[model samples]
Target chain A: MVELVVFVLMGGGALAGGVTVIKARNPVYSAMGLLGTLFAIAVLYVMQLAHFVAAVQVIVYAGAVLTLFLFVIMMVGVDKEEDVRETIPHQRRLALALGLIAIGIVVSLVARGRFAWVPVASAAADPQATNGTVQALAEPMFTDWVLAFEATALLLTIAAAGTIALASFRRPVADTAAERTGV
Target chain B: MIPPPEINWFALLPLLVLGLGAAAVLLVDVQMKPHPKWLVRMAAAVLLATAAGALLQGWWLRRLEAGETVGTPLPFSGFLIVDRYAIFGTLLLAAIALLGLGAGQRFIVSLGRRAAEAIALVLLSTSGFMLMLSTPQLVMMFLGLEIGSISLYVVAGFSRQERQSEEAAIKYFLLGSFASAIFIYGVALVYAATGSLQLFEQQELLSRVAFVKPGVLLIGLALLIVGLAFKVTAAPFHGWAPDVYQGAPAGMVGFMAAAAKVGGFAALARIMATAFEGYIETWATVVAGIAVLSMIVGSFLAVVQSDFRRLLAYSGVAHAGFILTGIVAGEAGIGSIWFYLAVYTVQLVGAYAVVAAVSGASSAGSPLASYAGLAKRQPMLAHALTVLLLGMAGIPLTSGFIAKFGVFQDAFRAGFGWLVVVALLASVVSFFIYLRVIVTMYMEEPLEDRVLVLTVPLRLVLWTTLAMTVVFGLFPVPLLRLTAISLPL
Candidate 1:
């Protein structure tokens, strides 16, 4: 009964947050709604004992991504009116059609067999169900996935260098001088 | 305490050389006042060394095979596979980078201050694609894809002064992220279905386990195809190609298009061969369908483009269709795909080098009017372009014809005779697109008598590609043998 209550509360919160993110007129409000949805998802992850994923969800999505969103909103001016008119004819209708198709696929598969929806072969492929922890993740990161881990360092370097190349003007000496003198 | 995975340093030589070489170039640029020419040489040397390393590794693999030893060295717990296919891809990508950078040398020089960053990004992107080509695991492939794609995104908008370049950057970035999301979601679904990230593991599980319903797996496969199709600029998902190719700095566009094709197709081919080999009946038809669509769409669109760059973009789509036809043959067509990719990418770079010379290196548009009577003034460049364009159009006595033949034959042998027929019709339609350019160059009167500056590196690229197209066309036996041996099978 307690689990059912918690599930209902979090699931309802998530759905409401998702609806608000799409429906809210204000950009900031939409970002907050997104945060609410992400937080609900994190809580749901925790309930499933995927604590590592939950923490990552909170830290990365709720914390970092949401902050970035708000910063952009601040810079771009959150007071501006957003145009919600359809740019393409029948776009909403098309979207609704696609959504219906996806829902139909899900419903039909679920109705066909529970195993059809469920990942049945996953059990035989990997029966290990260790609690989500740093050790569980770190082992693979340091050993098997070490190349990918190191490659991320290069990816970050590219990101930094690329930003510098893109944002910095061609004549840096003149630009820096102008900036320093407040010209 | 657990020990670390066994490392094979030699097997990873191509990646190490390219990545460190990129960092080294950046460091050298900042530490001292290096000449722009020196930087170009430095970049060229790095790519050449990478190609040499790949060659050495291929030789080593051959030796291993001769000894009847521990087969298919999956270094780093199968994260990287040291096989002939990976070696071939590594070698080909390195060569393409070298040729692309050489062809774009004038543009690099014109960058003036940001030359090192541009060079470093090329090397880094090549290394990323090399990693992508070699990896057997999905997570590693995604990592490599992002590493390659993010760098290319920045490079596309290198001419930030142009609104078109900025628009291209944003469009590629946004659309690319969607494709990546779709791809990773497919990976997640595949993992959910089989609880494995390794393609072969997924394959083994799929063959062993008879699911009550494999709807999830099928959907995952479809999603994977869609994602890769976007990368290779296949039709219906190729909206970004013409704009991005037209808007990007002319120098690097060739590398960008070719690198993505090389890496994307490598992953696509490997995944289809290994993981979904059990469901060939389903995927083969779908691939055939995509092939036909791309050919029809790309060919028809190419005939209408006024911009030379946009025409090349559409032609690339058509070529992508031709290559997809090879994929319909499954593992049997790996050699043909490589052959097609090799000839096509080289031709693309050569063609773009001409565009860069005629239009400014960093300019957006390559208007067809600029090429009006190109042969009157710049005969050598015009001739080189003629050969390359003929190669692309799959004319007789050109490398393109041989490549088209190899792929069509492969598809036909694989019961895709109808696809081959459609592809031939597309090929004929594509002939006119290139012919239009040739006519504009040879027959049309000059718009102006202004001389075009042809750089040494650009000349070198033209000569190399022209010779390659002609020589390979005439003596295809050597390349055919090499490609046959390069297969993962």
Candidate 2:
């Protein structure tokens, strides 16, 4: 019952936060809404015993990603909201209607008990067997995923060096006649 | 303490050599004040070493097949699979990178102090694609694809002084990221459906348990196809090729184009043949449809392109279609696929080398207008372009013809006869595309009295490509048989 209560609260919080992310007029509010959603999601991950993912969710998403979003919002001077007029005729009405239809489908499906809240039975899918802790993740990451882990170094190198290659403001002798002289 | 997984160092030699080489090039660039020429030579040596590593792997694989104990072929827990296919693909990519380094010597030289960066990125991208070609694990494939693609994104915009180069970089980066997203999502869906990201494990699972609902799996497969199709620039997903080709430094365009196609086709062929073999009825028809569309669209659009780069880009699209013809046959066409990729990519680099010669090394846009009477202006280059263009057009006594013949025969035998017919028609139309360039080079009056001062490196690249095209066209047995052993995925 406590699990059910926590699930309902967190799920509702996530949905509310998602709605606010789009509906909020202020950019800061939108970011706050996004943070709320992220936190709710992280809480859900914790409930699933995917503790490592939940930590990453909190650290990466809530801390780093949301901070970046806020930074951009501040740097860009975030008073720009769309004019509250529909670009398309009845876009808002149609969106509302579609949203209603979506919610109706979900409600009907839930009422009919059609949703499989639990996943299929599998060794890999068992939360108790393969808890998403750092220790649980470490073995495969080093052994089976070792190549992928190593390849990420290459990917990071590309990112670092590629940025410098593209953004570096040094184009010395880009089209000099030395090329013509074959010197 | 858990024991570390066993790693076969022999299987990983090529990738390690390339990774270390890339790091060395960057370090050398910063530490030593070497001339751009020396950097080019260094990069070339690195690519050659990469090829040598692949050859070593090939020799080792041969010994293993002969009942010699050299350790497990699938090392790193099956993350890296070294086989004839991997060896052939690695050799092909490394050779192209080497030739590309030779062909783009002028472009690299133009960069002056930054030449080392370009060389390092090239080596890195080649290593990435080699990984993509060799790995059977889907997540690893994604990682490899990103490594190759992200490097090319930067390379595509190497001449940042040109506005179009920056535009090309942005365009390729955005579209490529989207394609990468689509690919990872596909991988996720496949994993969700099958509980495994390794293609071999997925195949075993799929063969064992017949899923009542295979919708998610099929969608995942189609998504994978679309993502790879974008990389190979097959029609309907080829919107960015012309712009990117025209805008990127002409010297490197061919290399960039070939690198993606080679890796993309290698992975595509393996995925279809190995993992989805049982679902050939479904995917084969889809591939045939894509092949038909690529041919028709690539052929028709190529005729109208006024820019030489754009024209080559469209012809490349058509070639992508031609290569897809080989894929439609599933397992039987692997040899043909490799044969076509090997020859066509060499021609691709050579053609762009000529373009780099005509245009300045760092310039964007080689207007077709500039090529009028190129034969009168520069006979050697005109003749060189003629050979490569004719080779691309699949004329008799050229490697293109043999490549086309091998693929067409495979498709026909695989019951994709109609695809072969469409491809043939497309081939005829594409002939006109190359012929147009040839006529512009030979028959038309010179737009300007510009002389091409052919460097030794450029000359060497041209000669090497021209020699390969003719030699393989006439005596295709060595390459054909070499490719045959790389079969069955």
Judged by DockQ, which candidate is best? 2
Model 1 global lDDT (CA atoms, 0 to 1) = 0.89
- What are the per-residue Cα lDDT tens digits for candidate 2 across A1-183? 666787899999999999999998898999999999999988887777677888999999999999999999999888775467757998989999999999999999989988586534333346465556667888888888888898899988887777777667454584555556788
| lDDT of candidate 1 at residue A27, scale 0 to 100 | 89
lDDT of 1 by residue, B1-489 (tens): 657767778878999999999998899989985877789899889999999999898878878879955655787887888888999999889989999899889888878778889999999999988888898899888888889888999999998766788899999999998998999988888888889998878888989987789888888888889988999999878999999999999988989999999999988998998888888889999999989999999999999999999999999999999999999898999999999998899889889988888888888989999999999989997898999999999998999999999999999999998999999999999999999999999999989888898888888998999999999999888988988777763
Q: Any runs in candidate 2 off by more than 4 Å, and if so which? A: A1-44, A76-115, A118-130, A170-183, B209-212
Estimated TM-score for each candidate: 0.84, 0.89
Residue by residue across B38-151, what tens digits does model 2's lDDT show? 988988888888899999988888788898865777889889998889999999999999989988999999887778888989999999999998999999999889999999
**CA lDDT, every model vs. true structure:** 0.89, 0.90
C-alpha positional error of residue A67 in candidate 1 after TM-score superposition, expressed in Å: 5.5
> iRMS of candidate 2, one decimal?
1.8
